[model samples]
Target: MTDDKTLVSRVLQGDMQAFRLLIGQHERLVAHMIGRLVKNNEEREELCQDVFLKVYEKLSDFSFQSKLSTWVATIAYRHAINWMRKRKMPMTDLAEEDHFKAAFVEEENPESLLSDQDMNGFVMTLVDALPPQYKTILTLYHVDAMSYDEIGQVTGLPEGTVKSYLFRARNLLKEKVKKCIGKEELL
Candidate 1:
């Protein structure tokens, strides 16, 4: 595995293989960032391709102030947000929060309804229902294992804002999961 600087330098020098390597290296990161927001399979694929295209075009402008993966993630995040905006999707509205909170408060202990695998799927489903900003922050922090600062760089959010959103997103998930478990037990 070449270092970022070497790989980037090679790509800049017109090394096609290096460019391919760059794509291979970052494709999963790109896919993860985009997949969480875009539900359509075809659209996700197209968006991923577009993200790489933009990355390649903008490679010369990358300043190396952050990790290369962070730079790529920033592109992925921006593309996903832009796509959502064009579709008029709600980016930050937490309309479901109140419903989940009510359900959570009404329920007692609700953690025993699911096995690990079932809980994982259920949590991911809940995550998919969150607003785009929260979803992006959660995905970048948890799935990608990025620190708050890195997530901030990727999402263009302040470090403190990233932490706050992550905390709120987790709390929302907790509330929703308890509500879901309570409902499941009643069934």
Candidate 2:
């Protein structure tokens, strides 16, 4: 198997196969970041493609200061944020929101009666219903197995900020999951 440096060099030399290999290696990372950040399916797909293109354009500037995946993720995060800004969408800011208020009313919905499998899906839906910042931090930190520093790098946030966001996001998810399962004692 070609190493990342060798593959990168080959891509720099205009090898399409090498470029494709690079894309294949990092596509999932890009998709994970964009998918959680961008809710619209078509927009997510388009933004993902845009991320790779931006990666390609900026490939020469990749200084190996971080892991390749981190660099790719940084690009993905910034691209999604920029896209959101361009669309005039409000970026989720906790300070701008009334944090003390409940995010949703606990109505007697069908989700409360779902099976374990369905409950897991319901949990995911709750996660997805979270603000983009919460979803992004959760996916990047837990699913991507990135350290707070790595998440900070990817999102251009301070490490403390990353940690705080992760803590808050987890708490929010925990509250929502507990509500969905009808088990307040779980927390």
Candidate 3:
């Protein structure tokens, strides 16, 4: 496995294979960032492609100040945000906790009555309903195993803000799961 600096240097020199390698390495990070926010599969796929294209175009500008993955994630985050803005989607701020909680929790649906096997999918659905910032931070920290600082680099939030959001996001999911479990017991 080549180091990121070597791979980036080769890509900057017009090495197509190195560029492919870069894409292969960071593709999951890009997909997870976009997937957490964008619901449409086609759009998500296209957005991932666009992110790499932008990476390639700007490869020379990468100064190695951050890990290659973190830089790529930043691009992915910005692209997803721009896409959402263009579509007139609500970019809800995390400060609106009451509004977020009210909108997120609702009457139990048929899908919420899941057996253990379906619990993972049910939890993901709850995560999907969260605002984009919360979803992005959760995905970056948990799915990608990134540190709060790395997540902050990607999302342009402070480390403290990242930690706060991650904590709040987990708490929100916990409450939702507990609510579902309590309701399931009544059935």
Best by lDDT: 3
- Using lDDT as the yardstick, the better of models 1 and 3 is 3
What is the lDDT for 175 in model 1?
Answer: 64
Computed on alpha carbons, the lDDT of every model, listed in order, comes to 0.85, 0.81, 0.86
Q: Which ten residues in a row have the lowest lDDT in candidate 3?
A: 108-117
lDDT of 3 at 45: 98
lDDT of 3 by residue, 1-187 (tens): 8999999999988899999999999998999999998999999999999999999998899998999999999999999999999999988877775645665546755353575347668778778877889988988888899999899999999999999999988877777667757654432
Candidate 3 versus truth, CA RMSD in Å, comes to: 3.2
Tell me, by TM-score, which candidate is best.
3
lDDT by residue (tens digit), candidate 2, 1-187: 6777887788889999998999999999999999887888999999999998988898888888888889999999999989989999877675543432244565746354465447656666666667778778988987889988899899999999888888888888786667566687766
TM-score of each: 0.85, 0.88, 0.89
lDDT of 1 by residue, 1-187 (tens): 8999999999999999999999999999999999988999999999999999999999999999999999999999999999999998766555456533442333433454355457667578678877778888999999999999999999999999999989989888876765566553432
After the best TM-score superposition of candidate 3, give how far the Cα of residue 104 lies from its true spot, in angstroms.
Answer: 6.1
RMSD of each: 4.8, 2.5, 3.2
- Which prediction has more favorable lDDT, 1 or 2? 1
Ranking by TM-score: 3, 2, 1
- Candidate 2: stretches off by over 4 Å: 96-113, 184-187
Q: Which of 1 and 2 is ahead in TM-score?
A: 2
Supply candidate 1's per-residue lDDT for 121: 77
